[model samples]
Target: MLSTYVDLAVGLVLAFLFLSLLVSGINEGLVRLLSIRSKFLWAFLRDTLDGPDRQGRSFLPAGMRDVFTALPFSRDARPRHNSMPSPAVLSPIPEGEAVAEGELTERLYERVREIDHPKAKRTSIATLPPERFALALMEFASAEPNGVQGLLDKLKAMRSPLHGHLQGIWESSAADVNRFRQQVEVWFDAEMRRLTLLYRRYVRWVVAVLGLVLTLVFSMDALEYGKTLLRDQAFREGVAAIAGGGDQGLTALKDRCTATGDSADPYRCVTEALSSPALVKIFDHALVGVAVPQNGDPQVKWNLGAWWERLISPGHWPGFVLTFAALLFGASFWWDILRRLTGIRSRAGR
Candidate 1:
């Protein structure tokens, strides 16, 4: 009986993993389609370099700002049609503080030219590494006669909070050029971590909204699904069996697809993996069995009317909320739990 309960729990978690995977796919799609990474990066860069003043004015010297304007990632360097709301409009950054991650490198510099310069084409860059960003900025500073010192002077002139931060880093290194660069890289890395946290927060809200919609559309009442798994022994055992191996299979599929040197389609590999037969089986078990026809037909017909009825049903509300709350844990979280539970099941079986 305890084993049966474990199987039931595994079955329920497996069901959630499937739903979370679908939601993750949708979130990734939305990110790419909207160029969310690019816009966020741009905003972050703006906040970092320009750092708003107490009066909310840009601290970036006009000369330095012009240099930034010429950079490939800058709004001025791209087509106007590709523009998003200005950093100020999106959200105000703290004075002297830059917003997020991405190394502004010579490669991105060159790539920007290839994509846009000589002719205004393409939207914006999707990613930049922190080390690359530090390298590129150092390269820019190298052009100055005073090199790193000249850069520090420029920073000091701004009297922005960043100047104080960089000054401390500079003094900590005994004003050594190479040490300063390395420290700057570390600083950028810290900023990137903050950016990642911010992005996750934004994604969490997106996931919540998506989870709610999916719950309603698929009639995935978690409470009902759990009850079903508990009552149906054969189904519970089947799900447990699949859960034991699903993670390995999915991981293998992703590894294979990613190894194929296809840079143009970042998600094609994932799409292939998610469309596997195992996922279909999970989907069928989770959603198809949720509702039964009153007329004794085995086929579960889903329609607006049926969905609306469920939406209005007071009993279904808890299920909807439960499902939505479960999804908030995200696909990766569910996958990890599924992997562990599957391991336990395998050990018990042995």
Candidate 2:
């Protein structure tokens, strides 16, 4: 009986891992499709270059705030920024022209804004590396014959927080370009860490919504499945056998699909592996309940009607909550638990 309980626990973990992996795959697709990393990088650049106004709002023109998303991944990136500042904002000053004492910040803002230019057919805000950003800033600041020294002179003359910030980086570099570049890289990394937290917050909400949708769509009632697994020994044992082999099987699939040298689309490869016959069989045996049609019961079809009926039932609320919460813990968490449970089951069987 204790062994049976362990098997039941393994089965539950296996199911949760499966669903969590599915969520992860879908999230990966969304991330790629939306260029989420690029968006966040652009946000970091925008906030850094624009600084803040007296009102504590971004110093960037109000119309250009969402320029981070004003790329292809955004909805109507072109049309949305029709009211943005004109090309003159980003146009570089002619050579040998007199640039203002503290105009480096303004120039930096213009270069960033160029990434969101509406008429530019090839503009893209790709991920900006710290080294590349530092190089660009250094080059932009060296408007006169004096290179690094001229850059430092401009930074010292600035009146904003950026002035103090860059001045500190300059002093720490001992007037060396390479050291300055390294210092800028460190600063960019720190700023990017903040961006990561903001991005994760956005992804957490996205996952919650996606988890709820998938739960209802698939009628994955955790409580009902738990009851089924506890009561049905044959079913429990069958799933536990699969769970015992879970690690090897999943690793093989992940390698063949995602880690292989030949596979072009890793996401599609993962989806195919997950939907393979063996994994499908695991789900088929596990989701057995009223949702499963009786053998030779022609009138009872497992269709949308059945799924919707199961989904809306009030008795499944506890199961729904449990399932949703489990999914939020993610695939890696559940996979670890499944492995531990499998190990325990193996030891117990001996």
Candidate 3:
């Protein structure tokens, strides 16, 4: 009786885990489909360059302008990349025509003061008017027209993902002389915002439909399942036994379980201990309650009519709602919960 009880409890845990893993796999696909994580980061970078007022008013050095232009959206009306012809380009100022250091530094320092940049590196040269900041960036640009790419190459060598993005921007925008800062700002920032919202709404719909399908396929009606769980006293007791005896359960399990740890667990050894017949039984039992039609079940058919009947049947509505609600908790939530429960149960068995 005790052995049979252990089998049932372990089977229940496995079933719970199976459901969680299914949800996790679908969630991963959904995240990638929408590029949900990367969108915010790209958006943040767009805002940083465009400034709050929607103007091309950032105070970075002018030589670096090409780096920002190639990203996401650029108004570069000219042909771009290696295949296309070049548009109008900014000619670097001749060496002699360029402002001398004392003059340039003074202008830069004054501009820095106007902007009130936090780090004061040029306290000795702040005698000029605030308008020199633009002049300073332009002069800085003129002084080293080709230098920015060299620095960019060095940055690329670092192999960081963000620097790689910067390099890509530079390559795409280097010959793009027609589209200026304002165009890039509008495309990357304002227009991208609309696209992001629309795509996210679409993703939500996909997740809902997917959730309902998974719910029905599993025959996991929350109401019926809840009754099944409640009627089985051993099942409830099994859950409690694995859930850990308050806070000390995990600690106690660790002390007692000589063969189990985070990197290793004895539960896997159960399979090794099983005979071939026992293994077959475990496998067979695992699929016993799954929704897929079984062999020779003449009554079971999943044709369009059956699907329509399932869809319209009021009896399935509560379960469908429960399933979608479970989906809202998401794969990560269930996985984490299961992981904790697993540790608790595995340790308790020791």
Candidate 4:
């Protein structure tokens, strides 16, 4: 009993220690993989862009006034000069109004060059009206062979206008680049969050499984100990005492006399009857048939057998039940703790 108890205590302690170590390891791994500087930086960028502070801000230049002047006009705003000739329409066309397609391209190219220059102003083309520049570029693309590429080359060669329009394009392109970068950051943050959640959940599952394994191991050990205790000679003796002394009581009470035939005295006949083989066989068969019969008084043999059957055999069932319950509870508790640690709850809800 002493050895069994000691073994059980040691096993319990070991199980606890193992569980603690497992949990600690899982937490450390999670932190290493998910908690890093890059993740924080991306998160910061995402939050900054999503905030309302930078809205309606223009990062564009000066001296580019005429470039954006006619941009706000709707596409249909152009006068139909040839639709209906009238006496009122005899006014001479302004030189600026009759500018050729090629001249417009050259002017646009010069403006782009001015905007791109290092000393160019920082103003937004979008703020001035994007339609004019868009329309001009579109008209230039239609009239030129190399599209925007041809226009870019011409703008690069120009000395005047100082790449101002190109600078505007660069600013516009920068905004696009920034916006794209922000999107990438947001996506990265979201993916990290997702992976972190998944890892946490996985850790929880591992903990639960580990705990269950520990419980089963502990319970089995306990059950084996209990079985050993039940089978111990000293324990059996105690149980036997409680069940009452067997066979000897019955033998002491019965007389060895009384026979139906061939006896000189009743005592002798009783003695012979007591020693009869047929009678012994009958009693042995009767004992075997009954579950727990009370025949006059309990004998030592009967007491021992009853004790073994009633006390020892039934103890195994309760032990098994307790062990199974312990394992189940351990598994459940481990799973809950793991879930909280990993941030899996939020992910599950989403």
Candidate 5:
């Protein structure tokens, strides 16, 4: 009886893991859809562009406030489109030195020159301190209609087509060039913080909505599955057989029953049940097509609609909520737990 209960518990956890993997995939896809990656890049650039020292002195020339622009990024925002280079463009140039990590200065200096003056001699700007790096940008932009001046001119010239997060701030700062950096910094800081909070909030909303939807779709009523295990002796026997499947790996797990922390990590039972062919049949069959009563009873086509009805029936919300709440633990947490269990179980088996 105890073994049967253990089998049931492990089976439920495995089911949760499967659901988590799918839901997490959707969550990550939504991040890309919303361009969260680009938002993060902009936030990071807000700090990097400022460099280490900024006491009312910087590399950008006088006309910079007119055309200062945020670095272009995101899947849709091509680096080659804007005067500012995108993060994605940082790559090894053939017949040249490999740009190492933490060497953004070198990469930017090399890349900007390539765009403006392809034949110019490459400089060792990457090793320079942040202060010098700023000067490098200033010098590079010093050419007629200087680089920075050219950038601002481009922004002005293409005002009709160009739209960016930094564009408005730069345009507005044209009135007060002296305090432009301070005002822009304040605005950038606030916007970045807001984006951070917004991203987190949206993620939770996605998880909750996704969890609830999956619960309804899969008939993952924790209460119902538990009740089914307890009420149906045949089902309990089948699940227990899965949990107690006779295999060398499982036997090793059993042999380690008394090993330290065995109770803390019930990997043996979980591993056996997860590997069970019967468990695979259960989930696969349920997910692929309209489900029907196992016994093919009359007036009992257990299709998606039928499950939806049962899900909305009295006392079903609690079960659905429980399932959804369990999913809030997320897939990464479960993976870490499974890894720990594997280690402890292996030690005990030895």
Candidate 6:
């Protein structure tokens, strides 16, 4: 009995330690996986918006400009130009250049004012500024059938350096984006693989722990069965009777015979002893009871039924409470591990 108690205590301690380690491993794995995924996502977004220039001077639409500015990239270092270059260099007509440039500037300013102040009383010209309207006319002229193909052929032949620069910028940006996306994918795959391995390890640990617990429980039961066999009365008596019944079996039996109170024959005494309630209780209690009392006489009749009743009585509520507490603790620990594993799987899937 003392050994059984010691084994139970050791088993409980080992199980607790095993479960704690399992839970800690699962939590650590999930946390690392999540951290990797977060870093990957942030890096992907940063690469997408910042481009390969890294100087934050990439041309973008107004809305896209706002988005890029919101990212972590540094602002453009060059100052923005608000006006066109001087006209003297644009045209070298000494006599009429000043008057022509002044009239052109005045007309352009007036046209911009008209476009900005359009109303029901405003002049019509598609409500567009003069520069925009002129650009649209130029685009239409460029698309005309008369010389559009010829002009395009000539422009292609020229192969402007600005076009090559823009193309190179675009290609480099695309390659960087592709590289960033690939890196993100690789990171994600690695994290998922790590998490999967962790999950498998956790499952294996749970299985091992469960197997250990079951083995312990069954071993305790087997030990209890062995103890009962050692303390059984009928088994001991059978062995003793077998050893002593060699030659005087019939005479010994006749000498031990007596008149029964319930029946008439002396041989009925043996049958009465066999049918005694005390003998029945001994067998019942030894097989199914909690504790076998170590009385002075090893062959004395044991009250196996009363022992069972005492062990399983409702009055032993403390045992039930302890069992319930252990179950609750185990359940909570299992639930925490399960939740952590599920979260890791879900995140990896994402």
Backbone clashes in candidate 5 total 1
By lDDT, the better pick of 2 and 5 is 2
Error of 4 at 24 (Å): 4.6
- How should the candidates be ordered by TM-score, best one leading? 1, 2, 5, 3, 4, 6
Q: Candidate 1 on 1-350: residue-level lDDT in tens? A: 78877777787788788888889999788766655655565556555654543456432223322322322244322223333322221111222345222222212343233333221344466456667766655664665567766666756655534567677887998978788889988998888788767766766777888888788777777777776565455433444455686443444343445675664343554444333423233334232443333357556543666556767889988987888889889888887788787764545456
Model 2 score (lDDT): 0.58
Candidate models: Cα lDDT each: 0.58, 0.58, 0.41, 0.36, 0.47, 0.35
Off by over 4 Å in 2: 50-127, 141-144, 152-164, 174-178, 235-302, 344-350
- lDDT (Cα, tens digit) per residue for candidate 2, span 1-350: 79778867887888889888888899878766655555455444544543443356542223322332443244221112232453432333333335442244345534454345443342244455566667667665554456666655544443334556677887888978778878988887777676667667767777777888777766777877877666454433444455687443444444555554675564565444343423233333232322333245534234565556766779888898999999999998997798677754545457
Candidate 5 per-residue C-alpha lDDT over 295-328 given as tens digits, one digit per residue, 9 for 90 to 100: 5653423466655576568777787788888888
Error of model 1, residue 195, in angstroms: 1.1
Query: How many clashing pairs per prediction, in order?
Result: 4, 0, 0, 30, 1, 1
TM-score of 5: 0.44
Give residue 325's error in model 6 in angstroms.
28
TM-score of each: 0.60, 0.60, 0.33, 0.21, 0.44, 0.17
For residues 1-350, what per-residue lDDT tens digits would candidate 6 score against the true structure?
56444443443433343444544565446434333222222232222222323244332212322322432133221112224332321221122223331222223223233333232222222123223433322242244453323322322333322223323433544635334334434444554455446444544444444434432222222223333433333333443574686543434344435323242454454455444423233234332333333345334455555555645655543533433233334434644555453443445456
Q: What ordering of candidates by lDDT runs from best to worst? A: 1, 2, 5, 3, 4, 6
Better of 1 and 6 by TM-score: 1
Error of 4 at 186 (Å): 1.6
Candidate 1 stretches with Cα past 4 Å from truth are 51-124, 155-164, 234-302, 344-350
Candidate 2 global Cα RMSD: 13.5
